[model samples]
Target chain A: MLELLVSGFAAIFTDPLAISMVFLGVMVGIIFGALPGLTTVAGLSMFLPVTYVMVSHVGLSMLTAIYIGGTSGGLISAILLNMPGTPASIATTFDGAPMAKKGEAGKALGIAVFASLVGTLVGVGVMIFASPVLARLTLKFGPWEYFTVTFFALTLIASLTGKSVIKGLLSALFGMMFATIGLSPVDGTPRYTFGSLQLTSGFHLLVVLVGLYAIREVLLTASSKQEPIKVLKYKMKGLGFGLHDMAGNWINLIRSSLVGLGIGILPGIGGSTSNIIAYSVAKNSSKHPEKYGTGIPDGIIASEASNNGSIGGAMIPLLTLGIPGDGATAILLGGFMLHGMQPGPLLFQQNGDVVYSIFAAMVLGIIFMAVLMWSGMRMFVQVLKVPNHILIPLIVVLCSIGAYALGNRVFDMWGLLLFGFVGLMMAKFKIPAPPFILGFILEYQLELNLRRGLEYSNGNFWDVFTRPISGTFLALTILSMVVTIINNHKASVRELKEKKEGTA
Target chain B: MNSDTKREVQIGIFFLVLATAYIIGTFGISTFTPFGNRGLDSRSIPQLIGLLVIILSIAHIAQVLLREKQVKALLENEQEADTLVCDEDEVACIQPVKGTIIERLDRVFSIKLLLSFVYLTLYIAAYQPVGFIISSTGFLIAESLLLVKKEERKRWRTFIILFSIGASVLIYFIFTRYLTLFLPSGILG
Candidate 1:
């Protein structure tokens, strides 16, 4: 293990191409992520084909850099513009936009950059040391166990529902039904293809992502308030933090990073939730909680730290169990497969070098982003000056091109349009698209596992309940639903009390 | 337009219609058995989803109706208080009536429907004859120009067009030549 680790570090330093690739990856990723509607997943997917053409190790390293950089680069727009560049940076805007309003945009940007660097380093450290243990533990999982784990992850939809459980469940059910549109996994029979060759292959996940997020966002923005909101031009200032500042916030940074890491390790929850949870924790524990959303550096720090830390946390499950922690990592999993590498326990034994290179590349990527964001803060902020109307249309065109470019299929373009319309309706109706997306992603695996479990038990329905792991997972799913209901009831009661007090 | 009221009514109607449609669709497809799987069929998942949707929709309609009643009562109380106020206070109280949910829904849906139609028309028109590059480039420039607000049109027209054209060209070259990904060759082929 020591030898592999040393060789990994040595190879990264000695191979000039690896270092250059990491740098280039970070640059490209930052460009994609700093642009609104372009997420880390899109960035990775767009670049996936290129990885197939390159050497496996080099490709993995470059892709890892892109993943890390893109995830961190979203903070740029979230801090500068009120619009979040990626969903992961949504929490950043809560305080970041306020800071910009208060003429402390430069200070906020500096703190975010610093925090991202520290958070990424901590996450990478955990990944390097803790991945093996996680892998060993997960290796014991059977089909029933996998099914239950997926069930638990899907229960996250309840937490995300936010005052509309019925609507949320309907949306999720719609997603699950959409997933059943392709060929059946067990019987090898065409399901909902409607006799079209295109439907037989199933909907491309990238097309779904672009349609749901980018296309939907563009369409929604078209009728939005036309009056441009004026943002103050705050001059770029110093890097702002000294060694003492770092030392003072070390505890907070570590705590937030861990929170981010834990969230990342979970299958469904990703950087978006991590940032929010970390920000809340940091604010709640602070001596001045009232200053949280009022342009405080701690808010930016907590958000950026946790969001970037999620990159490392997400990669753990992808590398070890072939289960993606989030959408971005799922795209990365596709890249891994493109490189002829299947992620799981066998991957560690067979391709340890490539894995270590990826780890090293992650660390280097954070370093690259830190240097670039620190030095190029002004350039990134200039991105905010681009009007939304112009920006949104360009994104629409790019999405069209991306869809067509994927397989040179006109049907894919049709798929993109169809999904975009679905996404628009969903947004208008206040249905959460994320759970639908998650359901679509997991649909294939869910069907495959169900079939395998059934085949093992000769169609005995009780087999799923008999397995300890599966049983535990089912219990947890039930527990999550019950908790969500109780919480909703409490919230309703609180609202009623507040109304009564207002009336009195 | 009171959006809350319109939303409640429209959503109730939408759920009822969707539930009926899903049930019919599932039943229509459930009969075809391409494979002999006695346990579960392709229709099973869709049927399950349809059932869930029906249940949830009924629940949502009930909730919406209950909430609407509460809101109506609250508004009645407020109106009673307003009627007791002096003329000057009544003038202050009588601000512009808020837009209804239907109006907001119309605003959001109209734009989305328009864009979807534009893209759909573009796709159909250019799928074969115009090819990917020419159609995509033209769409990009035209859409950018259209999306620009009227006041900024003069200031942004030149930059937006130039940037869109440049970006389209760059993407065309990158995907076609470097990445070796083939694009639709409509009429340009």
Candidate 2:
């Protein structure tokens, strides 16, 4: 493993184009992440197809670089604009905005950037060690195990990541239905292709992604009126602050990073939820909890670190189990498929060199992300001033280029618009998009494994429950749905009582 | 009911209709049972998913109806019921439009959103015939003019025009020349 990893670093260092591509990815990612509407997922979705013409290792490395930079870049707007650039940085604004108001904007940026660096390193470190062990554990898994795991993941995403579990499940089913449009998996039977050759191949994951995240985001920004942001001025001199600033903060940093890692390793939740969870956990553990939202470095550290940490946390599942933890990794799984590789237990044996190179690129990308945020802080702040009017059309053009590049067909571009409308409707209806995305990505595998499991069982559906691993996952799925229902009922009843008391 | 609840009910009905259509569509899928009749085929999962969605959608509608009734019952029995006034602005905004459903479609799809969609559709429609450079340049100009403030557009007009032309050409060269990707030249080639 160590030898392969070293060779991976050697491959990156040997290829100048790969190194520069990583740099470009990080720069592009930071720009996307710093802008309030464009997110890390959008960055990956738009760029994933652009990498189709590159070598697998170089392309994969570049995608991961974008992931690291985008996850860390949200602090820029959280501090300056008070609007979090991405959901991952929602908790950053709690202290970041206040700190900016108190004229410690530089101090806040400095601490956030540093914490991001540490968090990413922690996540990357664990991923380097953890993926192989997890992959090995999953090596013994069969069709039944795979089916149960995917089922469990779908239920987890549906229940955990949204306001309403039914809505989440419906969004997921909608995605699955869309996935079934093209050729049916394993059997080569066409399901719902209404005589169009383009429909025969179904919607490319890239088309669905670019449509849902990037194009929908553009339309969303266009429909809503944009308010002019008051740009805040700040300075960073010699790493902004020092080791003295980080004094007594080692435990908070470690604990938050671990919290981020834990959430990242989970199937449905990702960095967006982890940062907030880590911040709350930090607040609960802090001696002066009330000072949390009132211009403190503690809040900033917890947020930036955990979100960055989840970057690595997300990779662990993506690499080991071939199950993406979030939208970004789901696109990455698409990237891997585009490159003629699937990330699973067999990936290490087949593509050890590519996997190791991705790890190496992440380590290097984190360093580059921190350096870019500090040295290029002045430039990124200017990015907030770019009006959405020009920005929106430009993004549409760029994303259109991506959709077109999918099969060098104009059909995918139209598909982008169709899904974009669907995405917009999903948002308006309060149906969560992440579960929809994950469900779409996993639908084929779920069906494939289910059929395979049935074939293996010789028509015995009860065999799934008889196996220890599959049965446990099935039981947990039932437990989560039941719990969600009970909690939802209690919540509505409580709301009713509150309403009654308010009227009385 | 408040607009928020109304929206939830609308969402519930949307899913119910979708499930019914999906289940009907599942019947059209040609099943291949190479592993014998007992083994699940192409239509099985879709059929199962369609049924599940139908049940869930019904459950969602029932829950919403039951909750609305509970709240209504509580509100009617309250001595201070007059204090629980609805948000007038929201109620006025969501009130059914005074027209046929087809005419009311405009209420849901805003002009800006509709224009943007049309612009995108036109741009992609021209992508094969007019080429990426020409179509994209036109899209950027039209879309930017629509998005930019009317007053600001007059000042930024020249800049937007130049950027549109420059960006499309630049993107064309970069992808075709360096990335070795095939982009249609259409008549321009």
Candidate 3:
């Protein structure tokens, strides 16, 4: 691993282009992340087609760099504007807003940045060790196991994303249905092509991503017509607080990082939930629990740390099993597949160098993220002032360029517009998009394995229940759905009771 | 139904139509069973998916209808049905088109949204035929102007124009030159 790391660093630094790409990616990522409404997923997806012409390792490394930078950059707005620049920073506002209100904005920003650095380091560190081990374990997984695991992941995402599991199910089904449009798995037969050759190739992930995120975001902004938020004044002198401020918070930081990592490893939830979960955990354990929301560094640390830690946690499953935990990792997964690399157990043997280089890039990227963010804090603040009107249209054009470049044809660009509309409708209806995206991503794998498993069992589906691993996973899928439904029922019943009592 | 429930029902019905179309479309998917067809063929999964979607959509619509009924019952007990005023801003509250073209267009998407979509369509249509430089320049300027507030248009116009053309040319060169990615020059070439 150490030797691979050295070689990976050597590969990047020796090639000036690759180094610059990483730097550029990090900068763009930070800009995207620090902007309200633009997200890490949006940054990665918008930038995806640009990397298509580059070397495999270089492109992947650049994408990872973006991932790292975007995750860390959310704290800038969370601290300054009291609005989370990305969903990952939602929990940061609890303490971050208060901290800034109390004239401790600099301290809050510094602590958040430092905490992000630590969280990323810890997350990436674990990913380096855990990925290969998990990859090896996955070598034992057969068709049944793979099928059941995919099913479980789908359900987990369905249950966890947004509200309404039923809507989640519909969304996933919709995505899967869309995925089935291009071609049938296994037999290589075309399904639902409707005679257009482009339809046979179906929609590229690039088209879906750009259309859904970039185009949808533009239309939503245009439609809602929100005036851009003004950047607030904040005083900053140094790293805000010294080592003494961090002295008493070592355990909280580690615990929050772990919480982030664990949630990140789970399908469906990522930085969005992780930061909040970590914050709550930190608060519950703190001696002065009431001090959590009252401008404490501890709350900021927990929120920032866990979300960053989730970057690593999210990567583990993605690199190892090819299952993305959330939207950001899903885009990363698309990047991998775009490079013609299927990230699975055999990836270690076939593309170990590229994988290690990504790991190296991430480690380096985190350092760059922390350094550039603090040093260029004033610039990011200016970035926040870039109005949504100009920013939205500009990003749309950029994204359109990306979509057009997908096949060097106009068809994919049209696909981008189509999905953009779908994305808009999905948002309007409050349907969870993450599940649909994950479902779209996993559809091929799911269908392939299911068919293969059926073949292996000679069309007897009951055999899946006999294998311990597959059976356990299937059981867990059922259990998770049942539990979610029951819990939702209980909550609604309690709410109804409260409403009835109030009326009386 | 209230707007929210109406929205849910619309989505549910849309999915139902989608599922029906998909299931119908599956018949056109010719079967190819390689290696003696011991298990399910290519058509099986699509069919399964179609069936599953049908079930899910039914359940969704049913759930929405049930909830709407519950809400209606509660609302009726709370107050008379005559007091239920539909907000004009609510999408479901839009009556069937009955007036001028602008008023008719209001039944669908907003005029701004319609114009933006038209711009997007024109931009995409022009992307290949008219080339990257002309197409992108036009797209960026029109889109930016449309999206920016009307009051600020005069101030932003020059900067928008310069940036649009410059960005288009720069991007064309950068992609074609440094990145080695193709960008059509068309008449500009």
Candidate 4:
């Protein structure tokens, strides 16, 4: 193991091509993440094909680097423009934007970068040691277990759906319905193609994701006025603060990292939920909870740390079980498959060197993410100064290029537009998009596993309960829904009481 | 109804209609083998999803209606209070671009949005025929110019045109030449 680790480090650093690609990937990822509507998923999807010609290690390293940088890059816009560059950075805006407004943008950025690096290191450490064991353990999992785990993962819709669980479920079901459009997993029968050849292929994840995030954003930007951001005059003073600040938040950092890693290991949830969950946990557990969401570093640390930590955590399942942790990892899965590298327990046994090389690249990527983000802090802050009129058009052109380049089919462009409209309507209707995305990604797996489970059980649906793991997950799903309902009820009741008190 | 409630109602109705279409679509799907195939058929999940959608949509519509009624009751009780009082607090809290609720709603339906969507539609339509370069260049220029503030449009005119053309050429070269990804060349090929 020691030799493998040493060789892995040497492989990335000794090879000039690997080092350069890693750096380039990080830079591209940061830029994409810094730009609102261009997410880590989009970056991965766009670059997946580009990596086809390159060797497996170098290409996979590049993709992994992008994931790390993109996950961290959201803090730039979150702090400066009060707009999260990626879903992972959503919670960053809670305190980050306020801190920026308070003229502590430099400090916010510094803390975010530092925490993200720390989170990445911790997550990578766990992935290196824990993945092999987890993979070995999960090797025992049957179709029933897979079905149950997926069911539990889908229950993460509870965490994502803001204010309305019903709307969230609706969105998720809608996504699953869309996924069911193509050929069936079991019988190879056409489901909902409606006689259209394009429909037979189904909607590409890229088309839906780009359309929802990028195209919808373009439309939104066009409809809104470009509010000029008042850039604060602040000195770049050596990562903005002393170690004393971080010393007090060791527990917060560790806790958030664990939260991120745990959530990331979950099949469907990733940084999108991890950041929010970490922020919530941090706030809930804070000595001075009131100080949260009011321009505090703890909130920023929690948000950045958890989201970045999830980068490594997300890789665990992908590397081990051939199950992608989230949308970005789903693309990464495609990248691996494109390179003819199937990730599973056998992967470690067969291609241990490649796995180690990826680990080495990830460690290097984290370092680059921290260093480059720190060095480019000044320029990234200036990114907010670019008016929307200029940025929006460039983004659209890129999005169009990305959609068209996927298959060189004009139909995808139309799909992009159609889903863009769907995204817009979703926003207008206050239905969350993340659940929908997760549902779509998980649909095929869910259906396949369910059918397989049934086949194994000889058509007995109750056989799921006979298997402990599947039964546990199904129980958790029910519990999650119930808890969500109760929590929402309590929240609404509290709000009503507050309103009544105010009226009185 | 309040605008928010109206929006929710529209969404509910949309889902309800979608549910109907899904059910119909599921029925149209070719089931093929009559028996002995598998545990669950292909159409089963879609049908289940369609039914779930119908139930969920109805429940959502009810929830929205109930909220609307409660809000109306609250509004009746607070009839003396100005309607904008709540809005003012939210607006102040958000400090959104263009401030005021009415202004934001106006912006939502702005001519720029209509023009942008229409232009995008035209661009997509023209993409294969007119080529990526021509259509993209044309789009970047028109969209950029359309979005720029009216007073600044003239000042930024030459820069916009140059930037649009440069961006188009650069993107074209990067994708086609470097990445080796085949983009629509049309006549330009």
- What fraction of the native interface does candidate 4 get right in terms of contacts? 0.62
> How many angstroms is residue A95 displaced in model 1 relative to the true structure, after the best TM-score fit?
5.1
Superposed Cα deviation of residue A359, candidate 4 (Å): 2.7
- Of 2 and 3, the candidate ahead on DockQ is 3
Q: Report, for all candidates in order, the number of backbone clashes.
A: 12, 0, 0, 0
For model 4 the local lDDT of residue A192 reads 77
TM-score of 4: 0.88
Off by over 4 Å in 2: B77-109
| lDDT tens digits, residue span A202-251, model 2 | 99987887798788878877866567888777878968888998887889
lDDT of 3: 0.84
lDDT, candidate 4, B3-77, per-residue tens: 567667888899999999889888887774455656588888888889999999999899889977765665566
lDDT of 1 by residue, A404-475 (tens): 666667777787788878887666556677677767766666766765676567667688888887898898
Better of 3 and 4 by TM-score: 3
Proportion of native contacts present in model 3: 0.68
Which has the better DockQ: candidate 1, or candidate 3? 3
Q: Which stretches of candidate 4 lie over 4 Å from their true place?
A: A1-11, A35-49, A77-108, A237-240, A265-299, A317-327, A330-356, B34-38, B67-76, B80-108
- Please give, as one word, the docking class of candidate 4: acceptable
lDDT for each candidate structure: 0.72, 0.86, 0.84, 0.81
The C-alpha interface RMSD of every prediction is 7.8, 3.7, 3.1, 3.8
